[model samples]
Target: MKEILLVLDLDETLLYATTNRLIQKEDFVAGIYYVYVRPDLEYFLSQLAENFKLAIWSSADDVYVEQLVNKIKPSAVNFEFIWGRSRTTKKRMSLTDEYHYVKRLSKVKRKGFLLERTLIIDDTAEKSMLNYGNAIQITEFTGDPHDDELLLLASYLEKLRNVENVRLIDKRYWREQVKSI
Candidate 1:
């Protein structure tokens, strides 16, 4: 199997949660209301796991991430690792000067995955701006049962599985194709 590194975002990317409210801490459960897992999420993830190294990088808290990923699979065999807000870095907003956390892809690179073979699937473009070309920005998911972003992404990733470098693939086309859907 190829070793493409795929970093995924949880909220609005893999699943849609109604709120970010903290609900529990004993067993690490949170966001139990109106949470909708993406259509084809399991199949998409299973396929991706076969073709690439899978890791989740969500802005949500660690407990929430654990709760969500556990629901996907109690053993969580589908993911190589899961990262929460603690793994992100705070950056000062240029416009408002307010500090906000951002997932620094560079942080993942330190874990031995080459940047060229890695891609971050996130809804927020700003979150991936640090590694512009390595991002596959998707539309924010809002509990749409008909959403096929992951299915389309599966096809796209399949084509790139054998490519020497994912960066060589035209990202504009990816953006256009995803947005058009």
Candidate 2:
């Protein structure tokens, strides 16, 4: 089987940034924002890098994304790509006057990755709405030191490593699926 490309979101999925300092010390600071990394992030990235081609795509300022990626990414693991808001397609909601930056998997497809074997992990549903079949909705990381979402996610991703078609699996209840396994 072809190697699966795992595209991860930056802000809420892997870390949280805020101007208001939390009780705990932040892992780092990005500009004016105090950033806290999700627990077990280094472990998660190192482990996944062994099984999947990893990349990052965020709907945030390009410079900000690059800065965070540089700080958190392990020295040995290399990302296939690190993208930001400029790469996303801006779309307006049908029912509300809200706009969301959508990551279209077709862009990845254009870069030679098969959509059937690709996966994107993100906290917000709206961001990956255009490619729901390839999306794994992770719980938002809000600077909790005890958060173990990445640990659980690593286990879940292990199960998907050899899947013939990752899109065929229903990942809507990924947490429940991971627990049941």
Candidate 3:
């Protein structure tokens, strides 16, 4: 697949947590969408589209995803690509958790791409344990209605571009090596 799947956690991750009152001068006071603040977020996402598949596997309910879509829609979006809620019987499992589910999913989705090439952008550190070494965990995104974590997220996202490029090159070289033998 020549596309990268970047699943974002909407609540605290993308949309900053709101307090009792949504003061006009506080959280999101500037009206800047979370996806819009990150420097090159669109470009980074676009780049991911160039090499791997793009889909959203959020643990959030579909309603939230719908609201986000209504707010800032993805460039290359497919309603089917949005998956929410876990369909497992795992006791004590959080309904609002797609970390482990995404790991299991990315493997099947990116089976040809290899798990190591896949990455996860989340604010929760615990979720990082989902795929351990295979996934890249990016946290501490304030979504401060500004470009605070832009550099951080973009840097990690850049690594994925490397992963995808290397994967293609490696595949090409491997095929050549096999043909020569």
lDDT of 1: 0.78
Give me candidate 3's TM-score against the actual structure.
0.57
- Residue ranges of candidate 2 with Cα displaced over 4 Å: none
Q: Which digits, one per residue and each the tens of the lDDT, describe model 2 over residues 71-146?
A: 9999989999999999999999989989999999999999999999999999999999999899999999999999
Best by lDDT: 2
For residues 1-181, what per-residue lDDT tens digits would candidate 3 score against the true structure? 3445555554455455343333234323213332323334555555456555555555555655565645544567442255554521122347764424332534434445445445555555454344444444444544444543534554445544656433233221222343353
Candidate 1 lDDT over 6-113, as tens digits, reads 899998898877755323222223446557777888888888787788999988888888778888653434676899988988788889887766888788878878
Worst 10 residues of 1 by lDDT: 21-30
Per TM-score, the best of the predicted structures is 2
TM-score of 2: 0.98
TM-score per prediction, in order, is 0.84, 0.98, 0.57
Model 1 misplaced stretches (Cα beyond 4 Å):
19-32, 74-77, 175-181
Record all residue pairs in model 2 with backbone atoms less than 3 Å apart, i.e. clashing.
none
Q: In model 1, what are the clashing residue pairs, if there are any? A: none
lDDT of 2: 0.95
Question: What is the C-alpha RMSD, rounded to one decimal, of candidate 1?
Answer: 4.6
